[model samples]
Target: MNFAYELPWYRKFINESDLVFCDGFGVLWGAKLCGYCIKSDNRMTCPDYIENLALACEQENISLFLLAGKPGTVDKAIAKLKAIAPNLKVKGHHGYFEKIGDENEAIINEINKFRPDILYVGFGMPLQERWILDNLTRINAKVFLPLGACLDYYTDAVYRGPRWMTDRGFEWLTRLVIEPQRLWQRYLIGNPLFFYRVFRALIASSWKNYSKMSKFWRT
Candidate 1:
């Protein structure tokens, strides 16, 4: 949602997405702080879900198509997933092509031909979401999951912090420390902005509710 504040296209894509669950611990925290009764355990990161999802796909005979990371990274992730769930049928293509023109069309065609039951796009935030928005209608998949950088984590290309840090919601801090140069602006600046927006929205919601209550009593 912080990205949504500045990126109108991202906001629109998120609003249009069939499923927009809270993947960030900060988002879950903000919802709880604003009086939403969401269980902490109910909040899931992509890596966490991927572990279970692979097993479920194996049992259910669901096919998967992975799209993300540099050249070869998706292949490594696919190998690991196959090892974990040998029964799982999966294919993948790296996410390093021109966003427009023939290359993009070719990639979409490849995915459509594969006809995966689930398609996971992990080409980072707004980029992944934008790609989905652009080609979602043309993609032949029962489910489209915008995984951000989860594929990197699965391939061990990126560290998602230790279990302790993640369980305590300090994963962002760990990531900031690990990739300060690349991610400082995102975690350092964007986090505070996200919280501020959440606070303002919470206040607005409370005020609207109070007004409705007062009007109902008066009537």
Candidate 2:
């Protein structure tokens, strides 16, 4: 729900990504309007994917690692995941560390020793993405999932709203109501800017298609 625009590094990372999934309602809606073949259910946030991830890892015996969040949030998230899939092999660390300093090396060493199948990092945007890219080869994980503030949701450090509100895309509103001062810019300003870009893209796409059709007819 945050940082959909105005971050050049993030955009560059996203463009270079091999696998990209819509992480928010705004992204999903924009994709649909742009004629993508994505279903609404496919637009899952991090909290929405934890259970399925835990189950899959439990069944396949794939080790998992939670590598982000506030001081205690990763531990709380680990506990919550254990409740869902008790047999799932998982370890975690807090996301408050320097990416290029001693802290980063310590984290990489821990993760390399564990050799997790999937490493979920919730260091928030741009940072999480950059962290993975910076240490992509050093980390022995098969998959690196960037989950922004997902740990907070699992730990109840952040309220994710009820199902009904979230289903209808009012989750942003709920968040704004809960933490207005912290989230005002994200929702109030960023949300509108995101939509405006989506609308502009839709129009441009339509114009391009029409032009192509007109040229084809003339030929």
Candidate 3:
């Protein structure tokens, strides 16, 4: 019922209503394929985004409930958040506890206890999106976002591209230069595969429209 309109990045939905945020480039790109409108700050450093978020939380007194990626990452992220916004309130921040399917009660418990205004889900994309879509009905947060790699990015555990590169959409290469070990596969293999699928989807859509036009002409 809450997910009435077409939603884009989790941030837009997050700022406005009860929702969750999902991260990961491919997932966000896929949202584009689905014709959703979301703000894309491909150049944003993870810390910069969180720093502003911290300011918002402190100023607004809005509680943030975090679901961090990988084990132990949440604690580290909280520490970084505290450094950014000394007075920021993290109602609840925890590492991944529930697996893909075994997440209902765990997430619901936090929602009931914290009733956070913001729910930052750090699970990677597609997975984060799927999780939020499945569990949003049970969530109490007014906003939920699945910001992929954003946590690590914020902690400076990962490197962000230069502003100019990001503006020109060459940020992917910058990442390769910064952390090739972590990203080689994602860019070298993953991006090419994604492009293929995206082009295929576009072609298919064009063909569908052409077929419809032909039918109308015959009629």
lDDT tens digits, residue span 137-165, model 2? 89899988898898898788988899999
- Which segments of candidate 1 are over 4 A away from where they belong? 206-219
TM-score (C-alpha) between model 1 and the true structure: 0.90
- Any idea what lDDT model 3 has? 0.68
Better of 1 and 2 by TM-score: 1
Cα TM-score of candidate 3: 0.62
- Model 2 lDDT, residue 31, Cα: 80
| Per-candidate local distance difference test | 0.88, 0.86, 0.68
Q: How close is candidate 2 to the true structure, as a TM-score?
A: 0.88
Model 3 lDDT tens row, 53-122: 8788988998888786666667777887788688887854554666444565866786668788888887
The clash count for each model shown is 0, 0, 14
Full candidate order by lDDT, most accurate first: 1, 2, 3
Best by TM-score: 1
**In candidate 1, what are the lDDT values of residues 1-219, reduced to their tens digit?**
777889888888788877878888888988898888998887878888786899899999999999989999998988888888998989999998998899999998999999999999988878888888888889899999988888888778888888998898898898888899989999888888889888898889999999999999999
Which order, best to worst by TM-score? 1, 2, 3
